[model samples]
Target: MGGRAFSLNTPPIRHDVYLRLVSKFTTLLQTLHEIVRVAPHAPEKITHGDIDVLVASPLRTYTSEEPIALLGAEQCIPGFPTANFAIYEPEIEAYVQLDMRICPPEKIEWEIFYRSYGDLWNILGIMGKRVGISVNQAGVRVSVEHIEKKNKKAAMVHLTDDPRSAVEFFGCDWEKYERGFGTIQEMFDFCAGCRFLDVEISQRREKITVESRRLRDLRPLCQRWFDEYLPKLMGEEAGREIELNVHSREGVLEEALGKFDKRLDHDMLVGMWGKDLFDKEMWRRIRALLPLGTKRGNIVVRALAKRLEEADLGNGEYGALCESEEWRREREANWTEIAKAEWRVILAAVQ
Candidate 1:
């Protein structure tokens, strides 16, 4: 497991304990730079699994080495422009995951907006998608045409630049868009007023089963947003409709899975299981099985493994899958041809 993995039975950090740790970390970060923003901002009273900080400076780049040296980080996982460090907190008596994202001063505002409010951003993203406005780490853009055609470069367009457009489209306050909310109540009020709240709730619930651990932690906030706050903001009738739709969708997915299982024969079942295992763990095994020879062969295998990992399928499964004789045989049988095809494609691209 990576540095952040904890047993499912791990207890939540008390709010007071969390604040003390954050205050200590913030003090240390402030000594490094003046422009540091901690996430889950201002008035949201909730338990956090990790602390996320955005550090911006005029400098071109920042590395994890500084933080590793300063904080005595147990592990540093390099993420190119952004890095994650596991630092021990004496108060909590456990390792706390800290994600430090270093960016140029110009991008600080957008970075803060992107990282601060997780559930709020998710809800806003749903609304943005409905109306063809895409909001991402890069920036908010109405369409792909906003992207530079030649280099495919794009800068994040500020929401404040055209606040009225978003306000009209999403029915949120322009003031809140410019200045971040001071309390969770403000966030609830803004989302509660949005016409797209139902859609946002539906999408959030749909992702509950499939979301990664980090995203899963936001479920409580989202649930409160829909189950309690929205109903009060809207009418009880609208709240009931939202709940009904969520239940309906869950039932439908469960029914489909049951039917699919019934239709799968023994070989089909094994194939499905194998496919799932392959998607998760096959790439590393493939790399391990690659025959040692030319530098190009090693490069191709590494590149393929990197690509699969980027796709969220490189690792994190039971090792027993890799030990299967059938899987090993199949992988070995196809590896030569796969490597040849990959090399040919690389050559074609270069030529």
Candidate 2:
């Protein structure tokens, strides 16, 4: 609306083709926004009749089948969608798909392929890790090995297969191994530097944990509590009593319980407790022993804030990618209010 005009073309699109086209277009636009850090300005738009795509004027046109061509267009590009696995161009940072016929969500193989690519790259990028690549007649082979500490032993490990597999093997119970090379962050770092063995491998390895150690450690604690303590507390004696335990002194537990009660009060009044039913007394006691101000709360809040800030509020300003400098500036015009609102919601939950 600001500088671009949208146009629609009335052409008959098969139902299947239309769905694929719409999905691809969305991903393309999102990727561009992320890469350019600017909103996309479509001055000329073109779309066949009744299609979901909204193009701006000067009228750029391309078929839904031609994903590469669609992605390369200057004004319009695809962006991320809620449920599709696709690649992003390094230059524009926009999401792209080479084949709409291949539904990423439905095709488990394709999903596996894309996810694996993202995973491999992440694992090879740790601080002293070197991901070595060699080209052979068969295919490309990439490998990473490093010395890591486990139970007071420095052991060398090999991760020479697909990144997705490495992540699965190493990060499955990451808290147990992340003190060394077992983390999604290591996986992401590996992905950022290494090329995919195939397209499938890259997509599977999309997300990595940079500071995963904290969560990794906490994961075991939660698991142990759920598996061992829950039953013991219930007096049903399930698993064998292990030497490892969480500090559960009555005084500390009582203090934790008190804090939990305060937070629960805030949460219930603000409607944050709808997701789960927690015992007020138990939570207060747990809060006493647990680190109260960990960044876990902030992480959840920031994630929600970022999502809301980028969401379209139906202000008739659709098609503008917020990552663009221009769009961000415009958003910043009212961004503070939105941010404050999100902060309030998150703070209430974490309290």
Candidate 3:
């Protein structure tokens, strides 16, 4: 769902223009025998601002070479298998923001299942929360503890891998999610059938005033999706009773901090103390302990930073965190304000 945003003044492109851009990239990937599929965005829209594509190859790893070759260097936004870029459309004579997610051949089906769902995926994520199941790009985990035990890596469960268990757990139609829909209209119908839109609307109306601005942006998008798009697709209003309990923000933070403590204790027991080399995994573990923009997570981050500074990892990756300008810049860009402040304090003390 994360991608590069274009200039504020950028105009949206017509549906045909969007298709042309999709076709251009599809052809380029065909040469490399990589399978490509465009996500079913609002096909009925007059104009689109972005394109999302799923690319899969037999190769275990993917580089940005193919996308860079087609879209050019200036357009590419750096990332791992998931790359963001902008392509110039000859027909529209404008640039279209494109997000390309590269998946391993074996995991392509699950990737397609997740990527095509769009907001529906967010709805499923909410369902996941109710049942203590965590769903993300990697796959689904039963709990935050399970994720930490695996070092926060997705265990890679395919959709077909006992999906019925998940559906039954959430009390939804297993067949619908499995088979999906033939058309975008059918997909909208599926959303209505689940009464997800109704619950979403109710939740938004109730929480909009209290939620952060970042969360409020979705309100308009949800309104347009249902109020405008749904009625046009379904002809009638959709509503149903949803039996899910909502947890308070404080409760969520407490659960996250508890999980962080467990992970920290595990690391300490495994001798990840001061002797281990500082690497990307260590950096990720520290960042993971600090959930973005959360005071509690920032507290944990500060504690981890102090602990790391007191330890000795020789002249390993720890030095880069303080001395390397590039590393500092990247960390600052990715970290939240409180986290950046904590990290800077740690670096100052160590120096």
Candidate 4:
């Protein structure tokens, strides 16, 4: 919500139109960038709603470019790390949307992998959650220490942002995937090919809508997967040896942690005392204890950090400290027994 917003009225284009547009657009983009690629569309995606393209440009410099002048786009909408150019097509007399995504020069491959194949992310992301893995724009992450009480994202550790890691994790041959699929069914098979995929768990409407979008309205690819493809695969995947987290949300996190070097980060997020999460949580409770505005709140936090560092104490051990006579005398911050008890419960997590 805090990020940039741009409204676009570009419409879908036929496959033939898309094919022609991509080539011409590629040539135009090359004039401005050394690395420019049209993220491949999903197989059998005959009518494309937009062209998702990525370019390697540091500082997200491409976001400011006026594609309207260069490519004769009808309008250009600027966004952070992305810019949507509505290309005018005299043939269809409609605007074809072309989105230029900016990535670090070194991350073009990962960006392309993330942006390619329309419904591919939705399929993998939905299935990935059930198996304690997360495939996002950021990269391939494994849900290492999710406590379930907090957002699942809090516990995810980046495995790798490289495309190879994802294909390997999903049990697909990278070369073939790079070559692309000819049909949507082929793409589905590739995703479902992952050893951990329990087709039954994946097909469930409840599991598919794991996030806030409950009573889900399925996207086109997902709609077909739920209402069609998965049902067809039931017989084939019936006797399949489903490994890890498919039947239950267990041990796979530890399994992933054992593989990656993110244990220290995982520990901090799950509540290693005095870390960022612990510091933020402590600051939250302390702020509640003393109803201070922004300016005073900032001063109190700095002072609290100094006190804790000087004492060689963790924030989790400060609940009792907050209730002490010295704390009240120094900061004029006093909490009632009710507040102190509640703070103890909150601090108990990191303690």
RMSD of each: 15.7, 24.0, 13.7, 8.5
Per-residue lDDT tens digits for candidate 1, residues 1-351, read: 223543322245566777787787777777676677776553566666667778876233435577687767777777746678777666667777777777777767766666656677665665454333445665554322222232223311223323344354455776775676767788777765554445334435654333322343556666566556655655545554464333332243233234334222322333434554564455555555555455766688777656644653534442455557876667555754686678678678878
Candidate 2 Cα outliers beyond 4 Å, as residue runs = 1-68, 75-146, 149-156, 160-210, 213-351
Model 1 C-alpha lDDT versus the unseen true structure:
0.56
Candidate 1 ranges beyond 4 A from true positions: 1-12, 42-44, 58-64, 143-169, 176-185, 195-218, 227-351
Using all chains and alpha carbons, the TM-scores for the candidates as numbered come to 0.50, 0.18, 0.51, 0.73
Better of 1 and 2 by lDDT: 1
Ten-residue segment with the worst summed lDDT in candidate 4?
Answer: 1-10
Error of 1 at 89 (Å): 1.8
Tens-place lDDT per residue, model 4, 230-321, is 67787665656455334444666666556666665555545432244444665566766654456755665666657555654544444345
- Estimate the overall C-alpha local distance difference test score of candidate 4: 0.65
- Runs in model 4 deviating more than 4 A are 1-9, 58-66, 145-148, 202-208, 212-216, 241-250, 271-302, 305-351
lDDT of 3 by residue, 1-351 (tens): 332364533467677776777787777766654688776663245566677778776333535576577565346676757667766655666666777776777767666655554555554554344434455565544443433344533322222223344344344677786676655565545555442223444435554333323333564444455456644543443333333234433344344335434333333323332223333344556577543545555565657556555653443444224445576555445544545577566557768
lDDT of model 2, residue 174: 34
How well does candidate 2 score on lDDT at residue 281? 29
Q: Model 3: runs farther than 4 Å from truth?
A: 1-10, 58-66, 71-74, 144-169, 174-189, 192-216, 219-221, 224-351
TM-score of 3: 0.51
